[model samples]
Target: MAAPIYKVAIVGRANVGKSTLFNRLISEKKAIISDIAGTTRDRNYAVCHWRDLEFYLIDTGGMGEKSKDIINQQVSTQAIQAMAEADLILFVVDVRVGATTEDRILAKSVNRHKTPKILVINKVDNNRWRQNNDDFYRLGLENQALVSAANGVGTGDLLDQVVTALKKIKKKKSKKNGEENIRTIKVSVVGRPNVGKSSLINTILGEPRLIVSDQPHTTRDSQEIIITHNKNKIILVDTAGIRRCSKKSGDDFEKMAVEQSLENVWRSDITILVTDVSEPLTWQDKHIIDEVIQQHNGLIILANKWDLVKNKDTKEYTNYYREFFGFARWAPIVFTSTVKKLKIGELLDLLVLIYQEKHRVITDNALSKLLADTIRRHKPTKGAGTKHPYIYNLKQTRTNPPEFMIKINFKAILHESYLKFIENNMRYKFGFIGVPIKIRVAKSQNLQDK
Candidate 1:
């Protein structure tokens, strides 16, 4: 049985090192850490285990009451939402700067929730700042701890206290949940800026768990959200929109955001490429597709904003994408509109199916037959004076984006077209929909053994 996941949110004003403390607690650099104010714009969640306790540690954006910027307001709203859901809140503050109005505002917001909280006085690495930490108690939370998240001082004691609090919360609930050992399917939603990637996720979740805006790159960090459907736990990762690679670019945060977004593709089991249906596909969209295919991730192409198109011909759009993205033609495409709530359920069903296909395994007997039929249908043409590759046997070596190994005659070369033919035949014989298959060729030591 899995222990119920209790949310412990780390909230503070801008540049208080909440993200740094979050990384220290989880022991993983899952959240982007920067000195820039409000580097974190969304709530980032990661599983944290301390001693005998396990819970989700949520890192939220800095809250400020004075910022009138729309994005800043959205950031504060996201932090408030995190506080509302958290079972325990860590109200982080910088001891050096003491408690300011921003900290007071965030503290008031955190207190609004009946949730239990601990005031974390951060950056007290030396005695000078440590002695003056009494001002933080003015926020009115009784429980408090002092630590420097940058150098990892006093963090272990802080976590010990956290574990104690979490234990109480766990005992009070006393809920025995099942499916602790169930594997989580990771699906990364990626696309160009303002293409509705986060909106698509919000639609599927049936709530605004993520911040949505007309502005590009609203989602800076790749946020992981866990949802259960039909007994399957799926982690949908909402990634930052990737811009065209150029020497001239956005700030360091945006650059890091793009790098992390691409990195999610490599880490996820499936990658859902969301494109704006109202506009023509650009090189950036194809660039993301290539990355997904290269990573061998189960793929689903989503055509977003279907309501805006005059010609709602799904087939036409599919054909156009297939022609342009010929390399990734195996990917399944779904048309979605967050505003109209189109195909939201269908997308979920397809996601589950694609995840299953990624792990589909074929027996060697079936693979041998597939190889024989492929060769008989379209044999490799013999090159002038050079022997063509003679493939004798084929077998699946791995699953989850299935990989096959082919044994060919030594001192012979196989054309790329022949490999394509084998891949095509494999797909036709066995359904490997929405999954990329890897075919590796190995030269046989003996040529005439067969």
Candidate 2:
């Protein structure tokens, strides 16, 4: 059995470079970083390994400032929750700014948790900034380290200390073998403002895990919840509604929320795009679909608020959207009402099916035969002043968003229509429903020799 993963939370006031440190530590730009304060309003989590020690790293929204706004309050609540759940907290502070009043308040909150913590003085890129690190010692934390998250200075020393501290916590492995074997499927609920994304998650959860309101942009952060249904573990991420920059009121917070929402789409295994059934498919909906396809993630077009649409011909609506979203014709569409809790269970069942299809593996023999038959049925047309395109061999290179490699002659003359035909035939034969497949074309060595 594998050892338990330690939970490490990066907590601090706004604009303290917590997200930068998180990206540096995880070695991935999972968290959106910006010069704007409160860029991160939700808890971003990722698993990081160092010297055989695997730990769950959580980059939380900035805290310490008191705000009467509902969104700001929720962000603070999420950060507090992350700190509480963490086995070890890295209380990040800016060395250049020194410790402000908010830092003191944040420190007190951290002390209340009584969890083992390390004082991380960030942005000590030079000797001048390093001198200011002494000011943070007054926070009364013994274990501390100075590092520059952006420049990668002194991070090794900080990680070494982190390893030493984590070694103290006893490992608690899962006893249930079946539970250990269960793979969690991450599904992000995404759409435009006030599309009932949070409400859908709450209804599906059978509880109000996320704060839902009628007000647009009520959910400023991406919140994640885990549930097990019929022996399958699923992680549901309720994200902020993405709005166009032109329509935006020029608020920095809203801009960051939009960026975070887009980031969540890439992070998830499947993206469920929720749209209001009453409204026609808007440009924002199409934009979200383009983002999902760009990320090569599984997609589901959810027509939410179905209960509100009166005397609507479901078939017409379906047909319209099917034609409107012809580019994403492979995505499954489901009509649901979070208010009525309609088709909520069916959505989960569909997710499981999509998850299986995304991970579906096809052998080289099967792919070779399918490609041969597909090319025979629809031969490639000759390009202007170029030889006819011929695919000599085909094989799947990877799965979980399957990718294929096709050895071809005259790759330059391979038209987009022919490639689309190949993809369509592959999907028809393999049933890659709700999954995007990538095909890479390469010059065949044997064809080049001939």
Q: Which residue pairs of candidate 1 clash? A: none
lDDT of 2 by residue, 313-393 (tens): 889888988999989999999998998999988999989999999999999899979987987798876455467776778
The TM-score, computed over Cα atoms with residue i paired to residue i, of candidate 2 is: 0.73
Question: What's model 2's overall lDDT?
Answer: 0.85
lDDT (tens digit, per residue) of candidate 1 on 48-134:
888887888889888876677888888888888888888899999999898898888778778888888999999988888889988
TM-score computed on alpha carbons, candidate 1: 0.93
- Model 1 ranges with Cα > 4 A deviation: 1-4, 66-68, 170-181, 383-385, 445-449
Q: Please give the distance, in angstroms, between residue 280's alpha carbon in candidate 1 and its true position after superposition.
A: 1.4
How does residue 382 of candidate 2 score in lDDT?
45
TM-scores, one per candidate: 0.93, 0.73
- Tell me the whole-model lDDT of each prediction, alpha carbons only: 0.87, 0.85
> Which candidate number has the best TM-score?
1
Model 1 error, position 272 (Å): 0.4
